[model samples]
Target: MTGGTSDARDRLIEGTRQLLWDRGYVGTSPTAIWKAAGVGQGSMYHHFDGKPDLVLAAEERAASEMQDQVRRILSGEGPAYDRIAAYLLKERDALRGCPIGRLAADPEIAGDATLREPVRETFVVLHECLVAAIEEGKAGGEFRDDLDAAGISYALSAVIQGGYTLARAEGSVVPFDRAVQGALELLRLATHEGR
Candidate 1:
């Protein structure tokens, strides 16, 4: 309600976002969130009903941000293939993995509908955006006419998510880079024009 109250709420949400990305729902405690946000426990409880409530808000913010990034890259100028390439090749914290994708592996998130919805919706939107781009490329003769846009889109997304997993497992970004490069190579081969 007041300016200070609003600022505390924003800090709490942001703290939740970072904690969720790093520690996951189960590992992230209310105290940790409050500490990260530099707010008192009362401030946290005043802004949210509980941990799940706060996490839902954080997940929503993460999903919205991810969607905005994907939309901007996929909808940008250049050929459809170029746009898709840009989306795939964008710089990322390969070792840390995707914020939303990482949530998919969390047991807490998997069991809770309120926490999982935003994560699920984020991927749904990502797949839809990729499919649209691939379809556009196919229509423009940039990609193979016989190619399946949905299938390709799914594969591309899988590569990115899996790349993060593999990279983290190896404790290096090389695996992530290779996975992305491999995916891009496959796309180039699939497209009529070689890039």
Candidate 2:
């Protein structure tokens, strides 16, 4: 069927994504990817050049998906702080950590410019969206005009990434929730001051 080849390729990509998230780049073996994908060796080879090439494809897919989510929340209708709050409170697999952030920390992926491109872009896009939301909030009279969009964006992003690390380390989501609450409390102060 026409769907067979496409399905095999999709399976391989999905498998690679899962493996990369579960085991980092160095630990994710090509054999494991193919086996998890339920595809033959020939099929795997047919779809990707090699591990590096396949990994690149998988990273790109993950980056795109993450950026999509960031945009949806940051660009959503509401007050700027509300949008940011929605993102900070967004549901995620806290124990698993951020998939893209995990890749960014992996030496193999971090060291390779080609492989790191998507990871970098995902963060860049998140930064841009957060900045936009902050600016929008200012314009809507929801935040103080003196607030620095870039600084706030960086802090928020750091809180999120760091929250993941803390959550995984403690084997609990409390740290992540606390981090978000801290950020939200500060943002709320800005909101009231703006009024």
Give Cα-based local distance difference scores for all models. Answer: 0.92, 0.92
Q: Model 2: per-residue lDDT, tens digit, 69-187?
A: 99999999988888999999999888899999999899999999999999999999999999999999889888888999999999999999999999999999999999999999988
Per-structure clash totals for the candidates: 0, 0
Ten-residue stretch with the least lDDT total in model 2: 186-195
TM-scores, each model vs. reference: 0.98, 0.96
C-alpha lDDT of residue 186 in model 1: 90
Give a tens-digit lDDT track for model 1, residues 166-187: 9999999999999999998999
| Error in Å for residue 180 of model 1 | 0.4
Q: How many Å off is the CA of 173 in candidate 1? A: 0.3
TM-score of 1: 0.98
